[model samples]
Target: MNNNNISIQDRSKLFAVRAIKAYTELNKRHFDDAGKVLAKQFLRASTSIGANLAEGEFAQSKADFISKYSIALKEASETRYWIDIMIRSEIISENKFSSMIDEINIIIRILISTIKKLKDK
Candidate 1:
């Protein structure tokens, strides 16, 4: 999908897919069990960003939407944390981490802009 027209839900979904792909690549590289454990955490947090945003779309109230979106933003932040941990611990290569982080940052900016717009409304 075109980046300009992509919804937050779509962006977050892409993030999840990217996270899964990274995890699979790491597994193929024979990451240690500890690294695998971190990958699992990364996967959960990354996927949660989309899940929460999707759920929030049908929220019964504006307040509810804000709550869900807030949660999604938190998940995005958590995903970033996991990515940083992976890089610092040398579980994932710097190049891989940089790419992954760049994608997540896009999602983060989208979420922040969405939340700000919602709050303003």
Candidate 2:
């Protein structure tokens, strides 16, 4: 992801890129039985964050837009949960995920803020 200021869509796409790359490494480095399940969940939730946001761009109505954003937020939360599980389960290292954790946190916060703003408007 670039350091410059960017829209949520662009940021999310960049995040997805990083996440896909990490998913490949996760599969290679931690392919144990439980690790497979965790990695799949992680990939689904992480990618859904962007996929939902992208879908929201073409929402048919304001309510639909909020719904899609809400879904993205939910997926973001799930992604965090999977990450925590992976760390606790020793499927991945904490230090190695610090940056992605930071990125996901920012994405989650942004999703929350956007949802609130849309609802208020």
Candidate 3:
């Protein structure tokens, strides 16, 4: 799918997939036990981003939609943090996490923009 035209739901789902792959790689003993813990946290936050976005799609009201999007933004932010920690700890290389980080940043921006638009309306 074209990145420019992709919906937030699709984009977040794609992000989740990437995060899962990262989790898989990290589980392969990329670091110490602490790395696994961080990986699990990272996976949870990353996947939640999409889950919340999907929930927003079926929102019962404008406030519900905004709420879901806000949750997604928070998840995206948490994902970004986990990935950065991984990078800093050398569990995941900077090169490896760059795209993943970039993707989360984009998702966060989109979620923030969407939520703001809904609130403004």
Candidate 4:
């Protein structure tokens, strides 16, 4: 696989870029202290997904790739959780929450499928 192609690797790099931008915007919006904490956590978890995916691509074996991608999937789920909490707490709008959650869900599914396929090899 060509790592130079940002569109490859399950669109992980794209998702990470968008998530970082959104997190930056959210950080700059000056929410309450509690909201700020949740936002920071969410950003960290969301960005980790792409980082883990990149690592997985360079993994030495199928098992290693699966392990790394599994972590990415877990991080994506954590991001979704934080987004849901933030939205429910009124720290962020419903639209923003839904969009982020959808992206996270997509990533999670992609990672899960990739792991399963690798295991079957």
Question: Which structure among the candidates has the greatest lDDT?
Answer: 2
Which residue runs of candidate 1 sit more than 4 Å off their true CA positions?
none
The lowest-lDDT stretch of 10 consecutive residues in candidate 2 is 1-10
lDDT of 3 by residue, 1-121 (tens): 2387899899988888988887887787756779888999999999998898889889999999899899999999999999888888888899978777777888888888888888999
Quick one: how many clashes does candidate 4 have? 0
Which window of ten consecutive residues has the lowest lDDT sum in model 3? 24-33
Per-prediction TM-score to the true structure, in the order listed: 0.91, 0.94, 0.94, 0.85
| Candidate 4 colliding pairs | none
lDDT of 2 by residue, 44-97 (tens): 898898899999999999999999999999998999999999999988899988
* Predicted candidate 4 versus true structure: per-residue lDDT over 37-66, tens digit per residue: 998898888888888888987999888888
Better of 1 and 2 by lDDT: 2
- Model 3: residues >4 Å from true position, as ranges? none
- For model 1, how does the per-residue alpha-carbon lDDT over 1-121 read when each residue is reduced to its tens digit? 3367877787788778878888788778776788888989999999999999889979999999999999999999999999899889988777857877887888888889989998998
In TM-score terms, candidate 1 sits at 0.91
